[model samples]
Target: MVPQPFPRHIVDVAPSVGSTIWRYSDSFGLADPEAAEARLGLGEGGTPLMPGMGDLLLKVEFVNPTLSFKDRGAAVVVAHAIEQGAERLVCDSSGNAGTAVAAYSARAGVPCTVYVPAATSNAKTLQAEAHGAYVVRVDGDRAAAADAAEEAVGRGEGFYASHVWESSFLAGTKTFAFEVWEQLGRRAPERLVLPVGNGTLVLGAWLGFEELRLAGLVDEVPPITAVQAVGCAPIVAHATGRHFDPAPTIADGIAIAAPPRVAEIADAVADSAGEFMTVDDVEIADARRRLAEVGWYVEPTGAVAVAAAGQLGDRGGTTVVPLCGAGLKWPGP
Candidate 1:
């Protein structure tokens, strides 16, 4: 069967809002009558939009059910899997995505297996295992884990629930923009600063705002600043035509040396009149600590956007940054 195109139009339904993405299920176009009958969720989305350093607002995504924004996408992906009668799910991640998918898969009563780089933090791996997912540690980097997971799918082990490649995941993530628009009084922010690895959230936010724009809700999409670790900033390197050698960093979540959607990510940034920036481990550590002092305990990767916001200073209007993951996912010394 040919895959249905991702739904875009808002369906005619009662306009009642709730705290979860399902509140706007009609707007997201994922809650068809049949899918809604067997929908799966863990109360993802509708996270707080609170104050941050200087004039920046923090979209507290770490408060998500899996303690990361990945829950938004994972919830939708798993629901799609179930809707398609998938018996098992397979995916790969450095940390947060694996844990999210595992948790959601468990919630859906489907077996799951996650592949991760051997160097992934124990806390993240343990989280996935705690959800009863079979965890496989690949010996090399993030890409190696992805390759192994793909091979498993190739061998008919399970449906590939790739957070990186799944459009349904983006459908769920688009709620970030919707929630932000609602929280900001149905208006779009002047700018969005987000950490990028596989560009899931960045692209999702763009897609959401574009939908709003097309629906005559927002004036225009906000400019997006995509942040990356200096150790593994392929996107920034691509933009600047500079050579980079991938290295380990405290912000492991954004340490993607070769994101499959690198070109799409670049185009999203450029189309929004945005720029890319890199922060080293030292800066990430500092930002994480600073946020902790203010009661936001996020992982180093989560602090990446905050770190870039500090470096960028006050440009103008409202700038929102996302604290993407819980610090406990990788408690550093």
Candidate 2:
């Protein structure tokens, strides 16, 4: 027997609820209109855009409800899951996505189970559990946890609220672009520097900008540069024509050995005329220190993009880098 098709993750149109996505609802793919309306309100979006060293403007996403940019996606995904009659929500995350799912699921009154890689920070795992989620630590890598979550979903145990696979989550993340556009005086930036694990943020930003350009709201979409840890830089390797063997990096959030959305990410990079880059752990740690010294305390993962900004060097335009997670999420100096 042929297997049934899963629900379409993203749609062309979403509901207008006066949030960051309302104006662009006609451009996004949303799973449930009711769930979109029922989305949790924990001050997820509207993060501040602050001036950083040089021309790099920092989109401070660490102030989000879950202390990470993942909340932007999780709010929409969990609400959609509940509207679709899901009794339980399941996902695999390095840390931030799991915490986001757990928090949103709790808000929606649904049980949540998050599978996290063994190397996930204790602070993040504890945050997820604090939201009343059942946390399972997978042995191997982030991909291993993703495999387990997929297996559970295939067994009909729960709805897979995957941050990577769920189109709505990407829609939620697209708000970053919209916010940036508005913050930048209704214009698109010249470049966007972001960290890529599953490539959710990069993809979402591309979609959002594409919609805006199509709507004649923006003249152009900014080139979106992605920063990956040197240890696990598949997209970088693919783009640069270099062989990659996964190593260890402090940017655990983007330590994805095999990203499920590599093709899509590569497409976004090409479409935006952007580039992929890699930063070693030492560089990440140094960047983290610099950011902290400047009073912007972000995790090592969030510092990857900031570290990469040095490579751009006097690009004559507004460059934006999203500080994706809080520094306190990890335990270190």
Candidate 3:
């Protein structure tokens, strides 16, 4: 079956009176009656947008039910799978996305299988296992796990709920932009700093804000800074015409050496008058520690945007950063 198209029009419907992303269901372009009935949310989205270090504002995405922002997309993906009469769900991740798909699949009463890189964090793997998902540890990088999951789908093991390839996932993540706009008094922020691995959030934000702009809710899409790990920064390298050899880093979440949507990711950033930046493992650790001291304990990957924030030249605008995952996801220093 063909993938659902990304939503464009924002209907003039009243927001639902809750914190769940289903509150914006009408905007996601799901069918009217089914939109109300097919809401499978565990209170994802509606995270706090609070002031952070200096002039930065932190969007605390780790407050999600799964302790990461992946909940937002996973919830919708599972619902779509159920709508398609899927008997089982399959996905691949380094950690957070698999855990999210597992949790949401559990909620939808669907069996799930998650494939993860062998080096995935124990905390994340345990979470998926606790959700009763059969976990397979692939012996290569993130892409190998993805290949395993796709092979499972090809063998009819389950529907592919890929966070990287699924358009429905982007539809769900667009709620991040919606919430950000609402939190800032129905206006887009001057800029958005986000961690990029597969560019799910970056593309989602682009789609969301563009819809808002088309609906006349905002003047234009905000500039986006896509942050990546210095050790594995294909997007940055692509943008700057630099060659980078893949290496291991503490920021495993953004350690994708070859993201499937690399070109689209670069276009989104450039379209928004934005740029790419990379931070090393040392910088990530320092940023994580600083966030901990400020009572926002985010994982090293989650701290990537924060680390890049300091390197940004004084653009003199309201900059927002997203802390994408919880510190507990990776307890090691």
Candidate 4:
């Protein structure tokens, strides 16, 4: 098969420029979705929004195909890569993104290589491998794994499908806001709380809401409350003028010592009248247990949203917190 030429840069193609590729693609605005070669049989979006503890509405993202919100972005990134005729997809992830890319690439019949930190959860790495991805364990931290992936991609070994750097991926994640608005009677919620690692979900939701407002779909965007693990919160530290050295945390998903988009996250939160809150492992564990009692059963990282919601102290309007990953990926309590 002849290789399709890759785009020189990723552009936010207007919705008018493309047909509806998925129910949410109308909101995503990626150009030429029908031309994308990758098509995963597994349904990617439409996670349920249900009632949660203390006036919190839960966006149950853990029910996705790979049991994490990462599937949303991976679906788009993999599709775009296939459209570009990539021989293989490559990415570096702590866990969820790797599993997501693995699953989507498998469905697309594309080869995949995922570089993951050695400390990544065993269950997550196993899941990636189960999806037929070649899992390469890198020594050191998440950033180190990312660097290795970049270097390999730089060598033209495979096309890079970075969750953090890819604009198309955010197009998929942006559906979160659209779904929330639709779920809440086509109205914007009062507030949104979610865990932040590389700030993909938070940033994507911001983009989603911004697009809605621009399109005159919603009058106002909700205040987005971004949650971070106390152990590793560059965004929070920058926002509050606090200093922190990265430490171990149960919320591995948001344990990003130096997020690539920290400034963007801080600026977006500030612009939206939202604030950043940090929760320790104990708080995350407690939140996880509470969610389990309520029958949610999410990973500690997913529980970070709930844990931070408790710290917000009565925002009053309807608040949505995303429960992003499944508890089955970690050891049972």
Residue 84 shift from truth in candidate 4, angstroms: 1.6
Q: Write the per-residue lDDT of candidate 3 for residues 1-333, one digit (tens) a residue.
A: 999999899689886457778878776655552543354567789899989687899999999999999988888788777777888999999999999999988877889999999999999999999999999999998889989999999999999999999888898899999999999999999999999999989999999999999999998999999998988999999889987777889999888878999999999999998888889999999999999998999989999999999788788979999999999999596
List the lowest-lDDT window of 10 residues for candidate 1: 29-38
In angstroms, the error of model 1 at 68 is: 0.1
lDDT of 2 at 46: 74
Q: Order the candidates by TM-score, highest first — what do you get?
A: 3, 1, 4, 2
Winner on TM-score between 2 and 3 is 3
lDDT of each: 0.89, 0.86, 0.89, 0.86
Q: What is the lDDT of candidate 1?
A: 0.89
- Record all residue pairs in model 4 with backbone atoms less than 3 Å apart, i.e. clashing: none
Tell me the deviation in Å of residue 128 in model 2: 0.3
Q: Once model 2 is optimally superposed onto the true structure by TM-score, how far is the C-alpha of residue 40 displaced, in angstroms?
A: 2.3
Candidate 4 structure quality by residue, lDDT tens digits, 62-143: 8889999888888888887877779889999989988999998999888999999888888999999999999999999999
- For model 1 the local lDDT of residue 18 reads 64
The residue ranges of model 2 lying beyond 4 angstroms of the native Cα positions read 1-39
List where candidate 1 sits over 4 angstroms from the true fold.
1-17, 27-39
